[model samples]
Target: MKNTKAMRHSGPSAELEAKGLHRLAGERVLLDNISLSVHGGDRIAIVGPTGSGKSLLLRSLAMLDPIDAGEVQWRGESVHGRDIPRFRSQVIYLQQRPALVEGTVEENLRQPYFLRAHRDKHFDRERVSRLLSSLGRGDSFLSQHQRDLSGGESQLTALLRAVQLDPAILLLDEPTAALDSDSTAMVERLVIDWLSEMPSDRATVWVTHDDEQSRRISNAMLQIHDGKLSKDVHERIR
Candidate 1:
C-alpha cells in the first residue's frame, strides 16, 4: 500500500525544502535551480548517472557544502547561524566512505557524543550492542579495530553510529556501494529496521544507482540529470 500522507495532493507542508538551489563550477552549473521537498515518512531515492550531481545535491540538502545560491529550510525555518549545528544534529549525513577513528570501533562510536553538539547525549553501550546484534554482529565486534573491519563491516559500524544518534533525517549517499550483495542486503535490512522503529518521525534520502534497490527502499523517486531534477518520476508500487 502507498503512504497516503506522502502522496497527498494537499494539506501538510514539507519537512525540508531547498528553494532555487544553484551551484556553479566556474562556467559550468553543477546543481541548477534544484528545488524539492521532503515530508515526514518520506523515503526518497535520488537516481541518475554518475557525475550527475546527486551527491552534490545531497550535500547541499545537508547544508554541509555551501550553496552558491538558494536556501535550505527545516520545518519552514532557514538553517543558519546557531541553527547550523543543531540542524546538523537532527539532519545527519553519511557518506559512502565513512572515516573511522584510530582506535577501536567502540571508541570511534563513543567519540561523537563527546562533540559539542552531542555532549548532552551519552553513549549507550547496551543499545548499541543490540543494534549491532540486529545486523549480525556481536559485542566483541565493537572492540575490533577499524583496520580489521571489511568494507561491509565499516559501513555497518558507521550506520550503527548514525542510528544511535537518532537523527530525524538521514542523508545516505551510496552507503552500500562498496559492499557485496550479502552486505548490501544486510545494510538494507538495517535501514528498514531503523526506519520502522520511528516510522512517523524519521525519514531517509538514499542515493543509489541500482533501480531495484531504489524501488525496494524508497516510496518516492527523484531523477537528477545535467544539474536539473526531473519532476515526472514515480514508481507505482500499489
Candidate 2:
C-alpha cells in the first residue's frame, strides 16, 4: 500500500502525517495499510483493547519498528532511516512507562539539553519549576532522586520534560496508565491545557485504553481491532 498524497490540508498545515502504515512480525500482522492525515492542532486518540495493535501502530509511526510494508511521510517527503532521528526530535514519543536515569529530577530533565540541538541553548530553570508545579509536583522535586520517586511522580516529570522539547507532534502511549486517579487527571489536564495554549498547528496522537481519558482529550478517535483500523469515529461520544 502506498499513499500518493501523504498529507491533506484545508489551509496551512504541518508536515506530520502517517501514510500507508503496514507492519508484520514474523507471520503476525501488526498493522494493515493504515493511513492518517494529521493537520496542525489535531488531537487524535487511538483506543482499543489489548493486543489490538494500537501500540504497534504508534511504534511504526514513530519509526521505531521497521515496516514490512508502507512508509511515513513528513512534509510530503518519505522519511527513511537517515531522517528518523531528526524527525523524532520534532515528533517525540513518550512511552507509558518512562525510564528515568539515576539522578535528580533536575538532572534527568536537563539530559536533553546535552544533545547537540540544545547544547548551546540555556536551560530554563524557571520553566522546569513551573511545569513541575503544574503537574502537582513542587520545586523540591528537582532535588529528589529519580529512583525514589513514585510512578506518578516520575511520569509527571517525564511528561513535563518532553513537552518542553517543543516537538511538532507527540506520540504518547498510555501516558497515564500507571497513575492514580488524581495523578492521571493532572497529567490529562496538563496535556489538554498545553495543547490548547500552543499554536494550533501542533498534533498529538495518544494511545490509551482509558475511554474517559480518550474522550476528554481527543477531537478524533481511531479504533484498532485485530491489527486493522476499524474506520475513523467522528463523534467523540458513544
Candidate 3:
C-alpha cells in the first residue's frame, strides 16, 4: 500500500519523505510501497511487533540497505548508491547491538577521527569527557577494554562516540534495550539533552518497542506493521 501522506517533492518543508519505497530479501518482501515524511527536528519513535520491518526502514534511511524500488528524498534530493557514503556519514546508524571494536573506549572514540575528514584535527578530550560524564560514566572508562564493559557501558560509549562525531541525524535501534534502569535513565537523559542543545536541522529516529521509553525521548510516534508505516501520532496528549 502506498502512503497517501508521502510528500511528492521535498523543499524547505521540514519533512523527510519517501515515495513508493520497497525492499526484499530473496522472495521475502521486507517493505512494500512504504512512504512517510519525517520533519526536521522530529524525534520519531518507530514501534511495532517483531518482524515488522522497523529496523529495515531505519537501515534504509541510514543508506545501509539498498532499496529495490522507489526513492528516499532528503530536502528534494534522491539518496542513491554514490550518495550513500555521504548520507551515512551525515546520518549515523546505531545497530541493535553496539558494534564496538576490540579496544579501549578512548581508542573507539578516536577511530572516526582517523578518517580522512578529521585526520588532521586533534581529538577533543574535553568534549569526549563531558559526554561520558553526562552519561554517568567516568574518565577511567577511557582506558577500560571494550570486551570488559557491560552491555549498558558499551552502549553509552558507542553513543558518546557518535555524538563526538556529530552527525546530522541519529538512527538508533533499541539503544537502551539491554540497559539497567539507572543506565537507561542516564542514556535517556543524554539523548534529551543532545536533542535540546542541537540545532533544528538535526534529527533522531529511535526504533524501540518500549512505550515508556518512547514517551520519554520522542515528540512523535510512527508505527510499522506488516512491512508498512501504520500512522503518525503526536506523543504529547493534546
Candidate 4:
C-alpha cells in the first residue's frame, strides 16, 4: 500500500523523520500514513489513550518494527541494512519495563560498551557517578545487584545506561510510569541535563499518558487517537 500524499524531502532535513509511515494488522490500520520530523533540541510528547498505536509509532521511528509502507530517514538519508546498527546506536529506545542483565547495576551499565556498535566507547565511572549523585544515589548504588533493585532503581539504571551511551535521540516509552514523584523528577532532570549538554545535537520523543508530564517535558505535543494523529498537530508536525 502507498500513501496518497507524496513523501516530503524538501526544506531543512530533520535529524530523524518518518515520511508517510503506515502499518497494518491484516486489514485494520495500526498506523495511518504518519509523517513527522524531529529536529535536534526537540522534546516531543505523544499523548493518547491505550491502544492508540503510540508505542507502534515510536518503535517504527526507531526502526525496531517493520512498516507496511513508508521510510525512516536519519539526517535526510534513508536508513537500511548495514546502517541500521549505527542508526539504532544513535537513536536508542527505552520501553516501559526496562530489561537488565542478571548482575550488579554497574555490570548492567557496562554491558553496552561490549557491543560492536559501542566498542570504541568505554564505561565512564566518574560521569555515571555524577549522574547518580544528581539522582540522590550514592556511588554504592552501582554495587547493588539488579535482582535487588526496586522498579524505580531499575528504571534509573536503565536510563543511566542509555545516557552513558550518549545517544543523539531518545525514544522514551513512559519511562517514568513506574516512578514516584521524586524519582520522576530525577528522570526529568537527567534527561534535561543531558539534552542541555548538547542542545543542538540531541532530541527526545516521549510517549506518555500523563498530561502534566507532557506539558513538563515537551515543547510540542501530539495527540494520537485510534491510530491517527489529531488533525491540528499533524499539520504542524508535517
Candidate 5:
C-alpha cells in the first residue's frame, strides 16, 4: 500500500524544502538551483558519482554549509539564529565517520543531552537498548568501550545517538559505506525499523552510491549530477 500522505497530490505541508539552493566555489557551480521538498514520512535516496556534489547538497540541506543563494525551510518556515540550533536538533545530519569519545557506548549516546539544544530531552536507555538489540546487539553492547568497537559498531553507536533523540528528519551520508555486508544489512534494518516506528511523523534522506541499497531503502530515488537534482528518475511508490 502507498503512503497517501507522501503522494504528490496530497499530504501535510513539506517538512523540509530547499528553494533554488545554490552553492558556488568561485567560478564553479557546486550546487545549482537545487530545489527539493521533503514531506513527513519520506524515505529519499540521493545517488550520484563521486565529486558530483552529493555530499554538498546534503550538507547544504542540513544548513551545515552556507549556501550562496536559496533558503532551507523547516515546517514551511525559514530557519535562522536560535532556530538553527533547534532545527539542527530535529534534523540530524550523520556522516560516514562518526566521532566517538573515549568512553562507553552508552556515555556517547547520553552526551547529546548535555547540550543546551537537547537539555529538555533525557536519554532513554531502554529505547537505546531496544534499537541495539534490533541490530543483534545486547545490553553488553552499550557497556562496551568505544575504542573496543569495530567500524560497524561505531556507526551503530552514531546512528543510535541520532535516532534516540527522535529527530523528525535524518540526513545520512554514506553511513554504512565502510562496513561489511552483514553490517550494512544491520544498518539498513535499523533504519527500516526506525521508519516503521513513526511512519507518518519521521523521514530520512540517505545518500549512497549503491543502486541496490537505494532501491531497498527508499520509497523514492533522487539522482544528483553536476549539482542538480532530477525528480523524474524514480517515481514515488504508489
Candidate 6:
C-alpha cells in the first residue's frame, strides 16, 4: 500500500502547473481534465500500465504535444505561442528512447546552444566533462559516435544533454525503460544527484512502470488510469 498523496509540499508558488487539461484521440478521450501542480522541491512519480495515457500526461505538461483543452502555466504565467521555445528551455522533456542525431555526443550536446532561444547560453566543455565524469565516464565519452554507443550510453548522453541546460522542471517518460539494471541505476543516480544540487528550485516528474523505482524516485505518487488522474495513490510502496 503506497501513499500517493503523502507529499510534503513547498509553500506558495509552484514551478509548473496544468489546469483542466484534456486531449482527444478520434472519439475517445486520451486525457480527461487532468491537472497537477509541481512546485519547487517536489518529486512526483506517474505510474500506470501501458496504453493508460501516462506518456500523454507528461507530453501535455511539457507542451511538446498540444492539448485539445486546458492550460500549462509556469510560475503562475500561462505559456503561449511565442513563449513555447523559452518555456521548453526552462522545462525540459526527455523521452524513454534516445533521439540523438548522427555524430559525436559532443556535437549533439552543442546543438541546443545554437538554438535561437538558447543563443544566450554558451557550451562549456569542462562542465560537460564534469557531468560525464560523475556518471563514471571520462571526457572521452564525448568523442564517442552517437550510433556507436550502447543503449545505456545513449540514454546517459541524452540525460547529459538535458542537464547542461539546467531546466527547472524535468518531465521524464520512462527514461530507463530500455536500459538494463546497472544502466538504469546509473540514470537514476545521475538524475537524483542533479536534483539534489538545486533541491529548493528544481523538481522532476518521473514516469516509471517499476513500482520500486517510483517509490525511490518520488516523494509523492500519481496514478493515471483510463485517462483519469488519481492525486493520492493509496497503494503501499514496496
The top-ranked prediction according to TM-score is: 5
lDDT of 6 by residue, 123-225 (tens): 9999888777877889888988998999999998899889889899899999999899999988998899899899978989999999889989887788899
- Tell me the tens digit of each residue's lDDT in model 3 across 163-193: 7776767889999888899888877777777
* Candidate 4, position 121, lDDT: 96
lDDT tens digits, residues 89-134, model 2?
7788899998888899888888988886656565689987776676
Residue-by-residue lDDT tens digits, candidate 5, 3-77? 222236224588888888899999999998887878777888899999889899899889999989989999889
In the predicted model 4, the residue pairs found to clash are none
Residue-level lDDT of model 4, residues 1-238, one tens digit each, is: 1221232323355888788889999999999988888878778889899999999999999999999998999988999899999999999999899899999999999999999999999999999998888777899999999999988888888999999999999999999988899888888998988898988788899999998888888877778887887655522241
Error of 6 at 113 (Å): 0.3
lDDT of 1 by residue, 26-124 (tens): 999999888877776888899999999999999999998887899999988988878888888888899999788888999989988988889999999
Local error of candidate 5 at residue 81 (angstroms): 1.8
Model 1 lDDT-worst window of ten: 1-10
Off by over 4 Å in 1: 1-11, 235-238
Q: Could you tell which candidate, 5 or 6, scores higher by TM-score?
A: 5
Q: Per-model C-alpha lDDT, please? A: 0.85, 0.78, 0.77, 0.86, 0.86, 0.87
Q: How close is each model in CA RMSD to the real structure?
A: 3.3, 2.8, 3.0, 3.5, 3.3, 2.9
Score candidate 1 by lDDT. Answer: 0.85
TM-score of 1: 0.93
TM-score each candidate.
0.93, 0.90, 0.88, 0.92, 0.94, 0.94
Ranking by TM-score: 5, 6, 1, 4, 2, 3
Give the range where candidate 6 is weakest over 10 consecutive residues by summed lDDT.
1-10
